[model samples]
Target: MMKIKRKSLFTVFLLSMFILSIVPMSAENVEIYSMEKLLDMYIENSHDIEIMELEYELTELKYQIESDDLDNKERQMTRDKDDFYDTKDNSSSQKNIDEKRDEYYASAKAYAASTKDLMIQEFEIKNQDKYVANDTAKKKNSFKNDLWQLYELDKQLEVLNATSDLYKSKYEVAQLSYSLENMTESDLNQALIDYEQMVLNSDTLINNLDMLKGNVYINLGIEPEGEPQFDIVPPQSISPVNITYNDLLSSHKSNSLDYEKQSYSLEAEKVYFDILAGVFLENSDDYQENLNNYKKVQLDFYNYEKELDQMVLDVYYNYQKTIDDYNYAKDTVELAQRQYNEAETAFEVGQISALDMDGAKLQLLNAELTYDQSLISCAKATDEIALLMDGISIK
Candidate 1:
């Protein structure tokens, strides 16, 4: 028998909040939600978790009915055995008694097999809550990560707005120059196109943010509530990785639900094939189908580890790259800030034009945008790697 390994809860402590009552937010008032608060609301509103709990209850009910039926059958078998023993004692022919005894033994063996199966069912029922918790944890982690992406998108939109404004100013200048016959018509047209494209990009990002928020609201089982504010900020730095890549891959493979599902399917098909072999010839249609299914599942199971290995490698390397990008961005921001400060001083002393100071300020803004974007990436990547490090039970 293959043992089912229990998965560790990703955020067990956070689950304590699930017991607390949720206050409904009014659409009229603005409410600021931290990532943690939003996650609590999402989990509380989740129909998936509720459905899983309901299914577990239904399974328990089914088990009870089956158990009761088995108990009745066992009592009947006991009575039948007693009667058989009595008949054997009074029988004159040994051969007739021996044949009847063989039939009774077969029936008893089948009863025992069913009882063992019920025992396994009882075990599954006992552990079903853990599975539900694991699933909830997975959703919570994934949703929290999504919120960071939305944060990054919001930052990108801010940069796009600034760039659009800059382009708009240039377009206006080009139009003025063209009116004076100093700029070519084609040049003015190019400036207008650039400004329009920037505006379009900004609008697309805004729409994407709204779409994501809509999905979030749907998950929270809430209507749009006056543009709820996001208060969570991504961490700028993460802890260093301690585990080797190979070890990480091993752990991921061991805990992967995909691998588990494939393994179960392979085992089930093998059992089916054995049953078919007993009932039909090897060349029969039913037997051949069963054999094919078993072969397919077997192949899938064999190939699964390599796929998982590659996936883990990508996640590991992505984490390292995000960290490197963030550090470089941070350094660039510092350099830009220093140059902007010098430009400001020069302007104050009438050593440089106001235009030069403005240019320096724009450089700083762009650098900061890059830093913010990389910060979000680093935070998300750190979370992903940490999930593997902590061994979050994914069901």
Candidate 2:
């Protein structure tokens, strides 16, 4: 019996060591950063932002190309006028005729230049407006809001970690109690089991924190080892516009890039339809093939417009849902905290069981989790709104 008891005690010692192994060595040493810093870090590191800037550069190049095309058209008209007069009868080479050709060419060139310049200027202005309207200022405020959420989650995790430590300490105490003949085998067994479970929970929390860090790194385009920092620059405030949602929708109907692209596509399609109706058909099969291609471009334009409308509606609805969820989660956390305080007090006064205390603690933990999730959702919703408004910063 003495040998059997020794073996049992040895087994418990080994189990205790295994449980202790789950305790994170670096938990207390890990650096915690504020949300503003995180956001700044993300932006600095984000590849997606770089890609968007590249796309903007490409669009600028395309505008320049179109401008050049207009210039070339004017140059060709000038050349045509010279050719026409050089071949005309010298007797009829009236200076008035030459003046008329010059005037006509000048007017055509001016009109083309004006239209091209207007388009290019409009595009540049819109690009600048997108950068200006982007809520970089609000981003810091949003980060502040997210910071509160992270703090809450951190606090909850801290509690769980502390609770795990408490369980381990209690298990040690139970072993001592057993040695002193004050604790039964059943009590010791239960304490050991609880300690093991708490260790698992602590490990899970650490894993979750690590995962969050990974996601932040991915979003910011930073390596995992990069030190994250944020600069809090205040945004230049703007006067509030009195435009309603309907007004915005109306303005966007024509001004949105997606809409504009669709309109251009539709116009191209109409040209194709004309070609397909044999309006420009020569005897050549090559010309007929070109006409067919134009028709296909038109069909694609209609499909694109339909897709864009659906996308706009989807984004709007998602933004609304995110706002609602954030409000609900915020309110729920307040209530959960209140309830937890009451339960803790009741438990301390012996008015509630340990199970009831645990339940309250779990409820508060869940609330904190939900609140953090809501903050993320709200940030994403804000991004969506910016995207819809074409107000996303290039880089």
Candidate 3:
């Protein structure tokens, strides 16, 4: 007889699944959903985001109407000034012309700024959509992880129950042998120890299961109407998309609302300068301040593009790392599966202890869980890339 040291069941608590440990419960047995469908559900009834969308729409409309009104006023002022000079005050028409030009320039600047603000509001609305989509992606990723753990743990617990049942049988046999003076005291004590260890491991698995149930509910965002039923299918193969990282970065640059907003800002600033060119004194503080603001906006726009470029590069490298990690995890699962097949055969032939068989099952379970975890990581990478590219789907 050999004494086997018990391994730590607590190690499972340190995995990615634990990120879901603190969430509130949601509705039970929700049908399985993809990343796209989950985002749709979150957007449909999400009041917090709805408010943001509405605010952006209202602001856009308000600013657009104001800008149009200002444009009309500037045009009308020129017309009125022209008619006044042509009909009534021809002698002092030059003064009227300069005054009206100044007024028109001021109105043009106001219209330009207000139009830029409308573009900003449109960008804000797009950002609101991105926020809703990104949060949904993260929560779904978390739920996917929790489900994978639950699946592996559920299998592990089932196998562990068998081990416990066998241990109990051995303990009973040991007790009878001790009563009959056929087994040593040390042997009986070891049997009892094995039985207790199996029981404790079972208890640990059950507690972890309960913790996962609560987290799944919270990620889904609905109160548990009843016992939540999870129907998760882990990935079997890596899905490859027909695009490259440069393609992704290029798409991101093209669709970026931030860039669009910056363009509008720069355009409006140019109009502001054009309007102020004849109106402002060359050496005045107001002229210098306006010039500085233009330069600052230009610099800020360039800095933003630099930041975006860096972000795209970083994400691409990380995505590659996740791909490598997933392949390694997949290989680990294959090795664990082979070991488990051997252990299972040995157990069936009565050549191995129930504890040894259970240990093999646990190893396989852990490997499967790791494989699923890598899949989740890949999913997150895909989601982040999609977010950056503004709706480019990654397989």
Candidate 4:
């Protein structure tokens, strides 16, 4: 019997382990979706936000219970007297109880009303209508911004693909150049190096494309299988305008979600102080406890203000960097185009050897890649700034 029981337990343990092993451990579930659809699903399924909502509901319920207890004050007083008093003095004590009950009823009603009001206020703070509206708008903007970014990334990938083709052409040219008996060992070595570099670059581009596709799948809640197609329309080009540090700071202050949340936090802390000082003062054991709570609120309020200021500064700096990078990339692309033109002219004139021309072509390709990469960096930086300002799309 003992042996059988042990065998059964061992079997159950093995089964449990097998089940655990089969369960999906990676949070990176694949799914296909548009940017808007993905954001909607994320908002609906956000466990953290739901938990906050549950806490608010629980508070409302607690307030209701207190309200009910207050309403039953008279009945409770009568029950208490019945349990304690004898029939003889009961009539006299009943008169005393009636007076006490009226006083208790008035106080209970006041307390219940106050508690209900505070609870409603807390609910408003937790789910402020204006804040909720702002948050929703922010989330929507963020989604649109992300979509723009994805579009930019797609363009970069296309550029990389084009560059890869250029590399293939260069490799072919190198082969032809090496076929010439007049080619020096140094010339052949340079050709080989150019071909190898192009191959490596093409491989890097393919890897990046794969990674971006995976991210898109995850964002859309789709199963990632086979080749992913990203249809991204580039935004209309905007002229480069001089934007100052102050302008960036202003933008961040107006748009940053983190800053807005911190502002709300400060307001909440003030409300907490008011409640602790006004309502909870009487309930507190001593002056010391009240003083401690007051100090804590002050400290929290100070910290929140500091945090908001720092966030504003950080976002402003990031935005500036993004703008600078975009400008630099624009210049680099122009330079690359000029170089490619020069190389083509040189190759046609036969002034430069095929190997040298190929080297120049590879250089132009690298420059173009760098320019595309910079463009991506700028877009990402813009998205980050938007998110900070609370301008992102949220459901």
Candidate 5:
């Protein structure tokens, strides 16, 4: 009986160990999406993009049918012409040859009409595809903007929560001092007010955080309650744009939606002008109107090129400003660290009170938070330039 009891106890111990091992694995199943993964998920779940893609597919299918019809018309026209020639060679009757010739001419006219219709259809399909692509780019930009805003709010919450702890600590110390008759009642009351205010601010931040998270979940087609918790680790160090200004400009020129659209319009206008020149006099109203349109598009194309250059320059300057801000913040942190070290030494030597040391520590915390905020701003600025260069724009 003793041996059996010991065996049972050992079995139970083994089972307990196995359960503990499995618990962590189950807990670890909670997915933590990085920023890139979050962006991917957001894009993947976008209803607007999905709808745009569906519409584009339908447009392509419609155009495909029209294109096939055009091919069939061409084939039929060729066969009719071939039949006309065959009749000329074999059918010596003048009436039959005349009928075949008329049939061939009618088929050619029909083919030309179909060909014109297909040209318009093909252009519509191309324009719709461009719209879908542009809309998707805009959605990606919107997602990045939203994510950056959330990240900024999260950083604010971090600072506020840290400040709350400091406030709570100060209030507790103030109460102890009041009890010992070392602090005035008024001062203790002030400390309590500060701590309560901190709590209120923290609560407000929490509410804002939750609201933003819910908005993000809704955008991602996810239920807030069922979504796995995630974290965003802000960039810790400043990353300078490594490319030259000329390189950035080149990319912007190549990828600019405005440029591409304007260029397409300009070419189309030139084609229209040629058609008008073939059909009408230069002084004719229709020809003049089309010529004006062609020149206007040419002017627009030139203006947009200049605008793009300025935009690239502006982005570069803004990125530089962020780097400067980060550098300044880093200096402030160094100063705060020195102050903290001095406060620590003074407190150890009984030269200052605990509350004074805490004040220095809070300053250090605030300075570090400022530095972190600057770093994130710098990173965000860098990313914005990259996106712009990558052809992301609303227009």
Candidate 6:
């Protein structure tokens, strides 16, 4: 009986140890997304990343083919050189030596070009890695901006609802006054029209909000129980870290995936051109044709570099205008706030109708919404330039 009791205690101890060891493995899944987690998912699962992976694999296969070809050519050249030494016919022996020497030189050049091709592929893989990282960051930042705008739409809906309610209530009062002959027929008709317009506007806004919410859900790859809520912290300032155009151009030129791809194309052309030039006379049609093609490719690459510089320039100027707009929107918000306060005072003192005060409130809401939009625009532009220049996620 003592042995049985000890066995039971040992069993319990073993079970307890197993449970403690595996507890962390049973952790719950995350239901809410932070920006960092979202960026991680995008980087891992994006179609562009998948495509880059496939391209890298294809490049490796091509490199292997070239390497194998070079190895086989070296073996053939070795056989020809041995035969050249062994052959009894003098002319035949000299011809064999010259042919083997030409093959050896050509094979050496081919191997060198293939080695550079592998290096180009390695560089491409790194550039593509940066591209995926930058693109994921850009997408996440855009999603955040959309979320902010979605939240603002919630406020806009509330304003529309309030306006609709006030209009309906006022129209009811105006209808009674018209029945008692205290209001003109035209005034009552106008009240009905205003109430009808408010209802129509409310319906339209609700539809729009539904569509926008769907857009957010589609981008996030998640289903929401109801309208999803965002926890947005207002920006302390809309301005981004200072970046000069020269600094931007330098980073972009060195790190740009597009530019790097173009560079690799130009390098590949040069490799092929070198091979062709080695086999043909400079005056031959094939050599001249290839030389012209090489020149054209070099020109195109040069032009594309300038275009990339201009792209950076454009992003900077656009960001500047967005900041200006944000500043202007702030001034408009303050003006609207003052006007609403004055209108509220006028309504309280019986100097303006309730409808007039509601109009002022609507104006304030619109100004605030516009100001919010400008802030988001400024933030998005800043994020875009950062993606182009730094390739780092916002979080």
Task: State each model's CA lDDT, in order.
Answer: 0.66, 0.53, 0.63, 0.52, 0.67, 0.65
By lDDT rank, best first, the candidates go: 5, 1, 6, 3, 2, 4
- lDDT per residue as tens, model 1, 343-370: 9999999998755666777788889878
The sequence of per-residue lDDT tens digits that candidate 4 reaches over residues 1-395 is 00000011112111110100111123366333433344565455444445656655666676666656654653554554354343324556676755554554344335434554555455555554445555554544454455445555555655555555566666566667678755666776776677577668767766776676576456545575456555543322222324555665566567645555655645554544453354232555533565676578668767865665566566557657766876786788788779878888988998877666756666666666566555545544554454444433222
Candidate 5 worst ten-residue window by lDDT = 1-10
**TM-score leaderboard ranking:** 1, 6, 5, 3, 4, 2
- What residue runs in model 3 are displaced by over 4 Å at the alpha carbon? 1-40, 68-112, 118-223, 346-352, 387-395
TM-scores, all candidates, are 0.69, 0.49, 0.60, 0.53, 0.65, 0.69
Q: In model 2, which regions exceed 4 Å deviation?
A: 1-208, 211-255, 265-292, 390-395
Alpha-carbon RMSD, each predicted model: 9.8, 16.4, 11.3, 16.1, 13.5, 12.9
The ten-residue window of minimal lDDT in model 1 covers 1-10
**Candidate 2 global CA lDDT score:** 0.53
- Per-residue lDDT over 23-94 for candidate 6, one digit per residue giving the tens place of the 0 to 100 score: 111227424334444445544545765786687678668767766676675565466445544452455566
lDDT of 5: 0.67
Look at candidate 3 and tell me the lDDT of residue 313.
Answer: 80
What TM-score does model 5 achieve against the real structure?
A: 0.65
The digit string of per-residue lDDT tens for model 5 on 1-395 reads 00000111112111111100001113335444433444566778878777877876776787788777877877887898899889989998999998987787667656655555455555656667566665665665566556556656776777788788888988998899999999999999999999999999989987887787677777766653443333444455654677778887787768765566666655655654564454334687755766787688788878877887787788878888888999999999999999999999999999998778878877887898788778767755666676667665433
Best by lDDT: 5
lDDT tens digits by residue: candidate 3, 1-395? 10111122212111121222222134253333443343344445446556756776786677677766766756754665465445445555677666665665465456546555655555565577664554544444444445556656665676688778778888988999999999999999999999999999999998888678676555446566556544344444554434577897898778765566667767766766655554456878657767887788789888977877778888777778888999999899999999999999999999998767767877786787778768767655655665566632222
Query: Model 3 clash pairs?
Result: 24-218, 26-217, 26-222
Q: Which stretches of candidate 1 lie over 4 Å from their true place?
A: 1-34, 58-126, 221-227, 254-265, 277-292, 349-356, 389-395
